[model samples]
Target: MLKVYGRANSINVRKVLWMLDETGQSYSREDWGRGYRATGEPDFIKLSTFGVVPVIEDNGFVLRESHAIVRYLANKYGRTDLYPADLKARAVVESWMDWAQTDLYAAARPVFHAMIVNAADPATAVAPTDGVKSWAAQMLRLEQYLTGHGPFLAGDQFTVADIPAGLVVNRWFTLRFDKPSLPAITAYYDRLSERPAFRTHGRNGTP
Candidate 1:
C-alpha cells in the first residue's frame, strides 16, 4: 500500500490527499510537520532534507514536494485524464500546477497566515489586506481562466491542475478576507466544493 506522511490540515498535504481521492487510489497517511509536530525527526529529515509535510513512500520510491506528489499520482492512476497523454494538453495542465506554487503562493501565503496562523481575527493578525487584494486580483485572472474554459481550468476533463488550485480556491473562499468582485470564481468554487473529496480533505481551510 502507498503511504503518505503529512498533517491533514496542511495546504500542501491537502493537495496530495485530494488528488489521491480524485484518482480513487487508497493510501495510508501519518501526521507530520508543523501543527502535527513531527517535522524534525531524524527519520523524516532523512526522507526530506527540508523536512516538509507531504512526503510519500510508494513501494519504497520516496517522493517529496506537494506538486510532485499530485503529478506522480496523476501519472500513475489517471494516465489519460488527470495527466493527459497528449503533449499539448499535459503542458497546459502542468502550467497551472506550476503557477499554483510559484505565482499563486505569493497571493495565498499572507492570507493563509493571517486567517489560519493568526486566527481569523484580523485585528490580532498581520492585516493581510494588501495580500488579500493581490490574491483577489489573481483569483480574478484564475476565474477568467476557468470561465473561459467553462467548468475546468483546462477544458471539459477535470485533471491534476484542479488538485493544487482547488486547495488554494478553498482557502480563498473560506478565509474571511476582503475580495474583489468574483462571481465567476464563486461559481467555479461552488462546483469544486460540491466534490466529496474536496469537502473531506481540503475544505476546512486551516492547517
Candidate 2:
C-alpha cells in the first residue's frame, strides 16, 4: 500500500490526494505538517531531508515533492490519459504543472499568508493589497492563456497538470479579497468544480 505523509488540508498534500482519487488508487495517509505532527521530527526528516509534507512511500520506494509524486503515480499506474505518453503532449502537461508551481504558486502564496494566515491573528495581519495586485496580474496571464486555450490548462483534456493549477486557482477564489473579473478563469474554475476528485481535494474550501 502507498503511504502518504502530510496533513489533509495542506495544498501540496491535497494535490497528491486529488491525484490518487483521480487515479482511483487506494492509499493510507499520516498527518505531518502544521497543526499536526511536525515534519521537523527526526523520523520525517529521514524520509524527506527538506522536511516537507506530502512525502510518499510506495512499496520500497520513498519520494517527496507533491508534483513528482503525482507524476510518478500516474506513470506507475499507466494513467496515460492523465500523463500522456506522447512526447509533445507530455511536455505540455509538464510545462503547465511547472508553471503552476513556479509562477502561479509564487503569486498566490503571499496573498494566502497575508489574507488567510495573518488575518486569523489580527495583530499580525499585513495588508494583502500588494499581494493581491501581483496575484491578479499573474492570474491575468492565466486568463489570457485559458482564453486562447479553452477549458483546461494543458489544452482540451483535464490532465495531471490541472491538479496543482486547479488548487492554486481555488485559493485565488476562496481567499477573501476583492478580485478583478476574469471570465475565462471563472469558466475554468467551474469546469474543474465539476470533477469529483477536484471537489473533494482541490476546492472543498480548505483554502
Candidate 3:
C-alpha cells in the first residue's frame, strides 16, 4: 500500500488525495503539517528536504512533491486517460500543469496569504489590493484560455492537468473577495465540480 504523509486541509496534499481517488489507488495517509505533526522534524526532513506536506512512500520508493506524485501514479497505473501516452498529448497536459504550478500558483499565493491567511490572524494580514490585482490578471489569462478551449485545460479529456487547474479554480471562486466576471472559468469550475473526487477534495469549500 502506498503511504502518504500530509494534512487534509492542505491544498497540495488535497491534490494528491484527489488524484488517488481519481485513479482509485488505495493509500493510507498520515497527518504531517501545520497544526499536526511538524514536518520540519528529522523524520520528515529525511523524506523531503523542503519539509513540505504530501510526500509519498511506495514500497521502498519515497517521493516528494504533489505534481510528481500524481504523474507517477498515473504512469504506474497505466491511466493514459489521465496522463496520455502520446508525446504531443502528454506535453499539452504537462504544459498546463506547469503553468498551473508556476504562473497560476505564483499569482494565487499572495492573494491567498492576504485573504485566507490574514483573515484567520489579523496581526499577519497584508493589504490584499495588490495581490487581488495580480490574481485577477492571471485569472483573465485563464478566462481567455478557457474561452478558446471549452471543456478542460487539456482540451476535451479530463487529465492530470485539470487536477491543479481545478484546485486553483476552486480557490479563485471560494475566496471572499470581489472578483471579475469570468464566465468561462465559472463553467469550468462547475464542470470540475461534477466529478466525485473533485467535489470531495477540490471544491468542498476548503479554499
Candidate 4:
C-alpha cells in the first residue's frame, strides 16, 4: 500500500488525496503538520529536507511535492486522459501545471497568507493592492482561458492539470468578498464542483 504523509486540511495534501480518489487507488494517510507528526522531526526530514507536508512513500521509493506525486500516479496507472500519452497534449497540460505553481500561486500566496495565516482581513489586498490586482488579473487570464478552453483546463477532458489549478479555484471562490465577475471561470468552477473527489478534498473551504 502507498503511504501519504500530511495533514488532512492542507490544500497541497488534498491534491494528492483527490487524485488518488480519482484514480481509484487505495492508500493510507498519516496525520502530519500542525501538532501531529511534526515534519521538523529528524525522521520526517530524511524523506523531505524542506520539511513540508505531503510526502509519499511508495514501495521503497520516497517522493515529496504534491504535483510530482499526482503526475507519478497518473503515469503509473497509465491514465492517458489525466496525463496524456501524446507529447503535445501532455506538454499543454504540463504547461498549465507549471503556470499554476509559478504565476498563479505567486500572486495568490500573499493574499492567502495574510488572510488565513495572519488572520487579517483581505477584502482587497490589505497593504499594497498589487497582490490583489495581480491575483485577480491572473484570474481574468484564467477566465479567458476557460472561456474557450473548458469544460476542463487543458481541454474537454479532465486531466492532472486540473488537480492543482482547480484547488486554487476553491481558494478564490470560497474566499468571501467582491470579485470581478468571471462567467467562464464560474462555469468551469461549476464543472469542477461536479467531481466527487474535488468536492471531498478540493472545495470544502479548507484552502
Candidate 5:
C-alpha cells in the first residue's frame, strides 16, 4: 500500500490525494505537517529530509515533493489518457504542472500564508494584496489557455494538469480576493468541485 504523510487540508497534499482518487488508487494517509509534523521527527526525517508534508512511501521507494509525487503517479498508474502517451500531449500537461509549481505557487503562496496561517485579513495584508494581484493576473494567462479549450487546462480531455490547479483554485476562492473576470477558470473549478476527490479534500479547511 502507498503511504501518504500530510495533513488533510494542505493544498500540496490535497493535490496528491486528488490525483490518487482520480487514478482510483487506494492508499494510507497519515496526519502530518502544520497540526502535526511527523516529518520533523527523527524517524520520518530519515526518510524525507526536507520535512515536507507530502511524502509518499510506495513499496520501498520513499519520495517527497507534492508535484513530483503526483507526476510519478501519473506516469506509473494513470491511464495513458491522463498523462498521455504522445510526447507532445504529455509535454503540454507537464508544462502546466511545472508552471503550477513555479508560477502559481509564487503568486498564491503569500496570499495563502497571510490569510490562512498568519490569520490576517486578506483585505489588510499588503503582501497578500500584491500577491493576489499577481495571482489573479497569472490566472488570466490560464484563463486564456482554458478559453481555447473547454472544461480542462490542456484541452477537451481532463488530465493530471488539473489536479494542482484545482487545489490552487480552492485557495484563491477561500481568500475572498476580487478576481478578475475569469469565466473559463470558474467553469473549470465548477467541474472540479463536482469531483468526489475534491469534495473529500474540501471537508477540512487548511490548517
Candidate 6:
C-alpha cells in the first residue's frame, strides 16, 4: 500500500486523496501539521524539505508535490487515461494542472485569505478586491476553452487536469461572492460532481 502524509483539511492533500480514490489506489494517510502530527518533525522533513502537505511513498519511492504525485501515481499504475501516454496529450493536460497551481490558485488566494483567514466571521466575510476580477476573467477564458473542448479542459477525455481543477472549481462555486457566472464552468462542475471520487474528496464541502 502507498503511504500519504497530510491532513484531510488541506486542499493539496485533498487533490492527492481524490486522485487515489479515483485511481482506486490504497493508501495509509498520516495527519500532518494538525491533530497528532507534530510540526517540524525530522521524519517528515527528511521526506519533504519543503514541509508541504501531500508527500507520498509508493513502495519505497518517496515523492512530494500534489501534481507530481498525481502524475506519478497515474503513470506508475498504467492509468493512461488519467495521465495520457502520448507526449502531446500529456502536455496539454499537465498545462492545466500547472495553471491551477499558478494562475487559478493565485487568483483565488487573496480572496480566500480575506474571506477565510483574515475575516472576523468566516461565514459572512467577503473581501472586495481586484482578485475577483482576475479570477472571473480567467474563468471566462476557461469558459471559452470549455466551449471548444465541449467537456474537459484538455480534450474530450477526462484526464489528470480534472483532479486539480476539481478542487479549484469547488472553491469558485463555494466561495460566497458576487460575480458573473460562467455556464460552461458550472456545467463542467456538475459533470465532475457526478464522479464518486470527486464527491468524496474534491468537493466534500470544505473550502
Q: Which stretches of candidate 4 lie over 4 Å from their true place?
A: 120-128
- Deviation (Å) of 82 in candidate 2: 0.4
- The positional error of residue 108 in candidate 5, measured at the CA in angstroms, is 0.6
Checking candidate 3 for backbone clashes, the offending pairs are: none
lDDT, candidate 4, 75-142, per-residue tens? 88889979999999999999999999899878888877777766644555343366678889999999
Instruction: Write down the TM-score for model 6.
Output: 0.93
- Candidate 3 lDDT over residue span 8-76, tens digit each: 888899999999999897899999998899999998999888999899999989999899999999989
| Global Cα lDDT for candidate 6 | 0.85
TM-score result, candidate 4: 0.93
Question: Where does candidate 5 have its weakest 10-residue lDDT segment?
Answer: 198-207
Candidate 4 positional error at 34, Å: 3.3
Q: Could you tell me every candidate's TM-score relative to the true structure?
A: 0.91, 0.95, 0.95, 0.93, 0.90, 0.93
Q: TM-score: which is higher, 2 or 6?
A: 2
Please provide the root mean square deviation of candidate 1 (C-alpha atoms, Å).
Answer: 2.1
The predicted structure with the larger lDDT, 1 or 2, is 2
Q: Extract clashing residue pairs from model 5.
A: 33-36
lDDT of 5 by residue, 15-97 (tens): 88988888898999989887676667898788888988789999999988888898899888747888888999899888988
Candidate 3 differs from the real structure by a C-alpha RMSD in angstroms, to one decimal, of 1.9
Task: Return the lDDT, model 5, position 199.
Answer: 75
**On a 0 to 100 scale, what is the lDDT of residue 5 in model 6?**
92
lDDT of each: 0.80, 0.89, 0.89, 0.86, 0.80, 0.85
Model 6 over residues 40-113: C-alpha lDDT tens digits? Answer: 79888988888878888888898988999988889888999888889998888889999988988888888888
| Model 5 lDDT at residue 51 | 83
**Stretches of model 5 off by over 4 angstroms after superposition:** 120-127, 202-207
Which residues of candidate 6, in runs, are more than 4 Å off? 34-39
Give the worst 10-residue stretch by lDDT in candidate 3: 118-127
Give Cα distance to truth, residue 39, candidate 2, Å: 0.5
lDDT: which is higher, 1 or 4? Answer: 4
